[model samples]
Target: MSKKKLWQSISIVVATLILSFSAQSEEIYTQNFDDFDDGEIELGDGSIIAGTAASIQGGRLQLTIDGQGLGFSSFSIPPLEGSSQGFKITFDYEMFDSVGANDPADGFSINYGGAAMGELGSAEEGMNGKGVQDNLSFEVDTWRNGDAEQGVNISGYGDGRDLNQLAFTNGIILDDGQRVEGTMEISWYPGKGASFTTTGLNTNADFVDVETGAFTASDDHTFIISARVGGANQDLFIDNLVIETGAGGDSDEDGLPDFWETANDLDPEDATGDNGAEGDPDNDGITNFDEYENRTNPQNEDTDGDGLADGVENGTGDYDGPEATGTDPLVADSDGDTLLDGVENPTLPWDEDNPEKQPGTDPNQFDTDGDGIGDGSEIASGTDPTTEDEADENSYRQNFDGFADGTTDLQDGTVIAGAAAEVVEGRLQLTKDGQGLGFSSFSVPAIPGSSNGFRITFDYELYDGPGANNPADGFSINYGDAQLGELGQAEEGMAGGQAIENISFEVDTWQNFDAEQGVNISGMAGGADLQQLAFNNGPILNDGEKVEGSIEIQWQPDVGASFTTTGMNTNADFT
Candidate 1:
């Protein structure tokens, strides 16, 4: 092969290799902090060491506070790129006494600043004495006391001026049998300052607004895991130290980091600040996702649960039962009857007047009688339910006269007989006993359909009277005319008359000279006149004579007309 041809083949292979390497570089960054066993420093200070202290498994390193051994051990990595921004640091740590009694002279700190460990201040030295510059450090100190002036400085870097502190007073101490297990997280926002939270120490609190400038702009920073114990009497245990950048730890994706959630007793997986589990906590069968999305009670079986639900119980009135299969829990009864509350009784058929009795009560109760309806039905019909049944006529009836006109008589005999008569407003009234001897007259309206022919019937009696010296006084019927007196006049021997075309028989057994007749008059039109006749010189009966009777006059009105009566009986009575 020619040298030029060989070189071309090598170039082709090199291009393919470059492409393959580029493809394999898809991952951003990954670290579980489990690489300490290899005795290799992937990044950061080769001086930082790892070993086990208080536990079987080991992932801890130590740094002396005398400022001589392992000066500022650090772990460094490149920042995440693209729109995928932010970085987080998390770790677990414990503090203890090296010689068996509590030691107040030991401390440690984790710092992030520029890329070199030299940028981190010494752990045991006050912030003022350390030459560290341009950095943020969360220090755990066991020596500093109430001097808020020197512990965990937030801004300004030197002793007596350090603005933040996590002094001995703030450090958490475990009992003989207890252990400190906690996490600390620091999150860096692009344009915003760092935010952090610490647990198992002090108040186990969180804070933001540190003075490290903006974390996003400070790209190449080092992570230092360092500790110091002055006077050689303190020891510490560290486990589960983790450093993570980018996003997967937030299960809820709610922007709050996972470390903060664990420290705050909040569920990292729950976006709603409710329970952490994925589905309904009450096992009521509702999905937690749906509940959260819909703003419903994820733990409750019913959402609006007014005994009703969507798609089934609307407008049915049986809201208490299962969905559509049951009745609507609303309307009382759309049909206006007293039947179904909902379901099978959409058109309530049960009579409201006679509502169905409750389960154990009388089923056949009908509050209204004879109407074939119930009390509820009466109410629905707008009638009085309580008084719907017929009233007791015998108990309510009143007799105007001393005599009982039968207990069933709605009107007793207070109205008189053989006097002026008229039906006023559909009510009939009468006055008896002639006011002017045999010369008086009375009038009654012409009833409908009473023309061409009609009849009037009545009963009478004469209590006492001397036999008439001449012809007996009598009565007569007239139609649109007068002078029809003595209607086939009553002779002395005759007690009554036979039924005629429009006249009927009469009775006169009282012997008071006063008399009455059951009379029917036919062929009367427009108006009519009735008269009482006096036999030659015969006097009318006295007022002592009493009579009881009823009269009905019938007519056919080819056209409307009036009726009147002339000459009243001198003696008339009622009982």
Candidate 2:
């Protein structure tokens, strides 16, 4: 071959190699601090490391106290050419020392902009530490400032743009004072905008993704991982940084990629005004830009089919507030507790701590109280969701106050024993002048022997007999194994004929004998013949006249039984 022909072939081969390199994925930067000494870092490039208090320790960046009550540190990388296809930056971060402490101030961020480094200053400065224009920053705010704003924040800055501040109401995204370990990812597509994603940020989320709408992507950009602590103390650390370039493109310059726009029937060219990224035709309060980011349907209000609008569940758009649910928009069951977020809270701006419109459980947590039972189960079982506690499922209760309307009947399963027992004047009449005996029984499921305890309460009145000085046989409150309707003469209440082991509280109005007189609490073990009084008090009943009072009996398996009586005339020990 001739020399000119050989040169032509070599040039063609060189061009092909360059094309392949451009199309392929490449890792441009990575830092783990594995080889760095324990002290100030040495990046060797035109990198800036601010705050002398921080150092490279334990193969990670350890940032500690820099000032007396406030500390600040920042690590900035030199500008590098951005990939036209797409680029992804990932790193692991942790913040500690503010777990149980009060007022954990300031926070941390990962800033990408034209500036080489961020200004170590106020948290309200857009990026937590703002300095450059045409910047985009992701922040993890740890404290609630005077403006009543905290949690995770993502913002976009430009010269002629209205500062795009992504809305999120999860105050304090990182767990205070605890050692929180989480991964953060920043993906940038030139001319198409970027996305910020976080996983396990102690935010009770599997992952959270936010986006920046159509923005001018710079040809080259620098990075800064910065943190500040003011009016409180905290330690922030970072590790396992990786930056790479791969394939992604969005023709519309919206947050949604080209393929997604095509699939969703959205015009790729229409990203401005009111019909594309900024549009919310469904009126669910979530813009089309966010619908794409959340992988939800832009045309549907309840994209997850969970009976809740995306805005209500995600605390976005019109639902943004200090009391929003902060649940996942794309998921039906955000906490995976077998209950949908909509079913748990249902309304926007619901407080998990105190529910007013509905019995709102925490949509972000399965067990809101860290109890063994989930919030779904707690709500269903009528238990408190905000505290670790047990529920007494084996119990029965009845209130007679509703019966005062004279329209209600006895509660279901209530057993009335005897012809004289009836509901008259909105009260249970156990006995009348013509009838000598009556009984009312309520049987509850047996409680286990190794149980907490139980309580019984009652109110009674004895009035209007044939003679003013002579009342009837009186009444008794019984609990135990006894014949349901055993009524014996004028003496026995529930401890009458053929009774087994039981406890009976008897109020004797007739005073048949010395042993059977006064108010008595007796235990009938084998039979009525073997009954003995556990408590006895002198006569307190107003014979044939009005005498009203209440009684309470509490029994514990380990502590035995105790009794309390009210409105009794005699000063006697009922316990």
Candidate 3:
């Protein structure tokens, strides 16, 4: 043959061999229990298989049967050895008809000796084993009524008999002998000899091989799949049989097998899942095991193990006395204040606004008074902390009567009335009354206009005299004329004529009660005297009639002028 043709044939043969080996590495077998398929001696068709009828639906196989008297089925396969290294078995089944029957003894078994068997029977009876060599069987039983004896055999069955009952108690069996579906998955790890079984049919129960954790399978052995009829006429159906070998068995591929990983509470697939080992579990710059072993918070790094973290302590350099700044390891509050250890001292400028600052440290910190200025400043200025400063004291004046004297009588002969004193809102309110009356005076500080003079307000009441006409009169304001104050006039005697009154005017020295007729009394403006006077001209009777009043004299002290008043009274209630 030509060299080129020979090389081509060789390349083709090598490629074919590679493909064949790759295909052989992974193998799968499946059987659908259709009538056309066999179900008899070698799983042939048209034969009443001993066990239940297994069917396939929704990508899974199902076995259903009645646990009447007893039911059994068997199958055979080639010898299995290294192929058991990584293998998986999966199927789905359910029993729906278990009423009036002996506690639904339906189950499927995988035997590794030489055969596999599935059994359904009364809770008291189960399938007889069929192998004798080193064998392992996985059985999912529904009832536990069977005797717990081992290695016992019944007639018409094979070997390796053990009266171990099934583990599942509930299932769904169709009344029409149709198939009931469920899922059963089994995985084996060859190296570890460990196996795991998960079944969607009976979720509560999980079985594991006691000897070799490796899952058992039927190899060159008679694999019997069976079920028992609780009643004589009970029927069963089975379908979708699948057997496979050479599967990578590791579900998570995390180096650890899924079975072992699940048992040890470790994530098989995630290399970093075991945070207790090397990695930081809390992500606080500390390992989980270290955190568990040491009393210190693994997340934090305070040498003294104080509640305050090391980083936080060092960042703020306020170390309390005797406790070294960053080295003594004593986590004491830097300030002498009794706070938690490692708490930064707010006395330092760094944390001035901190709430931990000593109380009353700054009166301005919390202002109880709404005055724009803080209480500290107010106290410093000798001002009332609770009251606002009056805008202008001169605008209004209050008079005190008999305040200095000990007598409380308003009719005493020596009782004197002084000028109007303390005032607010253009009105003066006093707290004393003299014999006749009392008064206090306030000089109006300077203002800009000649027309800006003063107003006098007083509360007056007449008692026991001619109504509005007696010789004894009331109050008046004298402006420019020392005798006539800036505003207001006294009323003729009258009883019960009490009211608050106000009068305003410009002050002129020439405007006097005795001035000449044609002389311009309105033009004199130099430092004129403004006075508020209260007087009575009536005859002094055995018992004199009295008038009680509060007077407010308001004047601007623009020039070198002073004010005085008499016959005024004071009361705490101005209104």
Candidate 4:
């Protein structure tokens, strides 16, 4: 990737504000400490009366006075429904005074929880409460309690009294706050419950920001801002505290639910997010919805959009037309064929091996058969576009027409041998009339390139003799090194070619007595025996009959050659 050649647009939008959702209530509230001017000093909703020791002094609501005694205070608030925005609470406060450096006894808390102020407000327990346990709250501890996460002595990954940690008994926050702002945000959705994030700053600019992740919200709760001082040395004040909420509902006004917007880049909030299910953004003729359902690109008429409509090349609906191959909507010919991917792969019946045979041509090759013909032209021409020998050098199917009647050679390089080797009616006939174990072999010169595998196909007639009862002389098909001389030898079975490594398919037909006709094959490790085979139901041809078939042979380095036959006889298809 060259950085200099880069030309792209990138932008990141941060959600500084809460994401708005449909809400049952639009109620919102706030207090900037200016509400203190309303009348006598009071905090929150005034549901829980302020303790005598907890008073407003020098402006800020004093949760503890002159560090003299235990003090607790709370503000009643409208209870929020679980289905609403639930609530968002924010506040600012200053922790002042000097006392025990690491274990100061004076501490305060701002909690919005299930515990009631009436029970916790008792002087012996309530008004003097420093913290109400077993619930969620923000604790500002100016002391060290060994494991206190905010202990002054604790110094690792945002730990100190300079900031508050949002502790939880039931919820978690997704995104937490940073430093410098004692700003904490809590959001609770209807069924999803709530999460809290606490943040604060100090003189050194060092602070803590923790998110309480999220959790299920259960039961009802009120608000409290309390402080407790064991001695008269430290004081605590809280100011600018507020809470608000709204309905948490759907985002997009589309008559569909969020789950239905599974289409690519479909925004749930904007009605315009959908161009229309029927619209063809890619102009590929396929509707965006159909493309979505088919897992194609709607934005790109041609997912591979290379000058071709996705449909033109990919076929319509489940029907992959002739050109409807799995071509990229963005790339014309994924296989690099000048013929176009759609030309190579066409829509066809679903087959596990469809991909392997798609386009009817190699997507990357213009001439899959290397016969100097374009695949598109070949495919359209109604001829084999993949078989190199579909036509000979003269562009005609090679059927031995050029063999010159008595010759022993085929235009396609097939070399025939045997005293009886001759061209009869365009068929290279390899036979000897006065037969006694007579045979002939045809070795063609084509790289079949691998000893690993090769196939030979041809049509032939087994002369079963004119009489329906007359016995017939049989022949054998042989394969070995090409240099193997005469494909047949007098009476020593099928032999020839010095230093030869050969294998043969013997079609025995001297059916005299009970010596029935049979077909057996084997490597030249002597010869194959029908009885030695696990099964044999072959030589399925009567004397003097024609049949067409293919012989495929595969070789393993140390295992030599193995083969199978696929042929058509008058009786049935042998596979």
Candidate 3: tens digits of C-alpha lDDT, residues 416-533: 1242222222223322222122332222323334346555565643333323222222233334322211212222111111212222221111111322111011112233222222
TM-score (C-alpha) between model 4 and the true structure: 0.31
Between prediction 1 and prediction 2, which has the larger TM-score? 2
Whose lDDT is greatest here? 2
Query: In candidate 1, what are the lDDT values of residues 282-327, reduced to their tens digit?
Result: 4544444443323234444443443323234344333233334243
Q: Which residue pairs in model 2 clash with each other?
A: 98-177, 99-176, 99-177
Q: Who wins the TM-score comparison?
A: 2
Q: Please report how far candidate 3 places residue 29 from its true position, in Å.
A: 1.4
Cα lDDT of all candidates, in order? 0.37, 0.57, 0.34, 0.43
Candidate 2 per-residue lDDT, tens place, 186-277, comes to 77653235667777655522223344532334546666777777656666778987766643566767756675566556777778754578
- Poorly placed runs, candidate 1 (over 4 Å): 1-57, 63-85, 98-102, 118-120, 124-133, 145-179, 209-216, 246-575
lDDT, candidate 1, equals 0.37
> Candidate 1: worst 10 consecutive residues by lDDT?
401-410
**Models sorted by lDDT, best on top:** 2, 4, 1, 3
Q: How do the predictions measure up, each by TM-score?
A: 0.30, 0.38, 0.30, 0.31
Backbone clashes (count) for model 3: 87
Model 4 lDDT-worst window of ten: 153-162
